[model samples]
Target: MRTPAQNAHLALLLEVAGTPKPGNVDRHRDLEDLRFEHFLAGAVGAQRGLEQAANGGAVGPAFERSVEGMAAQGGGNTQFGALLLLVPLVRAAADDLSQPVVEAICEDTTVADAAGFYRAFDHVDVFVGEPPAEMEPLDVRRGSDAVPALEERGLTLLDIMEQSVPGDDVAREWVRGFERSFVAAERLAEADGPLTERAAAVFLSLLAERPDTLVATRSGEAVAQEVTERAAELVERNALETDRKIVERFADELVERGVNPGTTADITAAGLFIALERGAITV
Candidate 1:
C-alpha cells in the first residue's frame, strides 16, 4: 500500500507534469523535458536517501528515521510510484525531438547517462535548417533492443502521470510555456570568464569543510570512515569545486537572512535535498 506521503508526492509530480502551456512545439517540448528530468532526479535521490538511511551515513538521523518509517509502512513502494509518474513525461518530451539527439542518447552506456543527455537537451536551443543537400536521407530507427528496460520504465512513468493528472488542463498549459523559455544547459556549458572561475572557487571552499562534518555526523564508525575517505577523494579530484562557490554564496545569502553560518552544512544539505524532493533540480 502507498503511504499518504508517497501518494501526495505522486500527485504533485502529476500536477507539475500537467502544467498548461501555449502550443508552440519548442516551448512545450522544453518544459515537458525539464519537468520530466526533474522528477527522474527526484526518484534517484529518494532511492539514494534509502541507501544512505540504511547505511546510517551522513544525513541527519531525523531524515534517516523518516525514510525508515516510510519503508516500514510499505516496503519502499514510493520509489516505484515515482517511476510510474516519470515515464510518460519522458516519452512525450522525446517523441518530437530530432533523430540525431535521440540516437546520440541511445548509444550512451547507461540509461541514467542517456537520461542526463535528455535533461541537457531540454535546455539547448539550436536552429538547424532541413537536412543538408549533400547528406543522405536520415536513417533513424528506435533501438528498443539496446535498452529495453529503460524504455519500458520510461513508458511506465508516462502511464502513471496520465492517470494522476488527467484533468489539469491549466497546469499542462503552464508547462508548455515554461519549456519554450528553458535554456539551462546551454547557459551552464557556454558561459565564459570569471563566472566559471568563481564557481570553482566556491566549490573548493565547501570541499574543505565537508570532511569534518562527514566524520562527525555519520552514525557508524565504518560509514564515517567511508564518508571521510569519499570527501578526500572529492577534494583530490576537485569534484566539488565547480559548484562550491555557488553553494557558498547561496549559504551566505541564507545566513544574511538569519540562518546560522555554523549550521551551513546541515542547511545546505537540507536545501539540496528539498530541491531534489521538489523536482527543482533536473539532474
Candidate 2:
C-alpha cells in the first residue's frame, strides 16, 4: 500500500495529467506563464513536505516547506492552494481520514503554524485578495513581515483560514469541514474509466457546482458565474461522455480569456488524495 504522502504526490501529478480541465494547466493545455513541466517539478519538490505531514509533523512548518519546495521551480505559484488543502488532510490521514479528525487537526494548529503559513508567501506570489481595513497589518501579501501581527493576535493557522473564507474557496474548506473535497472524492471513486478521465469529469462537475474563487479574484464575479454556467451546460449535455470537442472548445475560450478555475483544480487535488487514501483509486 502506498503511504499518504506518496498518494498525495501522485494526486498532484494525476491532477495535472488530467486533460482539458478548462483554463487549467493540464496535460493538453498550458497557460502562458505556467507549464506542465513546472507542475511536475513542484510535485517532486513537495515530496519532502508531504512526507513531513505524513510523519505527523507540524502543519505550519510542513506547509511552509511544501510551498518553499514547490516554488523552487521557475513557476511562480503552481499549487499553493492545493498544498494548503493537502497538508491537513495528509496529517489527518496519518491517523483517521474522517471529517472530525481533519477538523481536530486544523483546530490543533498553533500560532507558530500561522507564522509558517505567512512565511510561505515569501517563497512565491500567490494571488490573494486584500485584507479588510482593520486587518491590513496582517495581510498575507505582507509575507513574513506579518508574522509579528499574527503572533500578537495569537492567531492559529485555522484562525487565518477562517478569516480567509469569504474570498478563498480553499480556506473555506478548512472552516467548513472540507465538504466539497470529500464529495468530489466520492464522485471520483464511483466514476468510470481511467483516473485522468474521472478527474476531468469531477473537475467539470466541481466547476459547474460553484464559481471558482480564483476565477472571481482574477476576472470578476460575472465572469466566474459565466464560467460556472458554461460548465453546468456542458455537464447537462453530457459532453465529457458524448462530445469532448465541445469541452475542449470551452477550455480554449477560457484560456483565451486568461481565466483559470484554479480553486476548483486545488479541491480536485485534495479529493484525489482522499480517494487514493481510501483505496477508492488504486495505482
Best by TM-score: 2
Q: Summarize candidate 1's per-residue lDDT along 1-283 as a digit string, tens digits.
A: 4322332233333322321111111112222233344433444344433343324322222122223333332212222222211222222222322223323322222433323222322222211123234221210011222234444455321221222231221112122321211222122223233322322222223324333222222233343334445445545665434544433343343223322111112222222222223344333
lDDT string for model 2 (149-235, tens) is 989999999999998877799999999899899999999999998899899999999999999999999898999999999999999
TM-score of each: 0.20, 0.99
TM-score of candidate 1 on Cα atoms, chains taken together: 0.20
**Model 2 spans with C-alpha error above 4 angstroms:** none
Per-prediction RMSD in angstroms?
A: 21.2, 0.7
Which lDDT values do the candidates have, in the order given? Answer: 0.28, 0.94
Worst 10 residues of 2 by lDDT: 123-132
Q: How big is the RMSD of model 1?
A: 21.2
* Residue-level lDDT for 66 in candidate 1: 29
- How far in Å is the alpha carbon of 251 misplaced in model 1? 3.4
Per-residue error for 138 in candidate 2, Å, reads 0.9
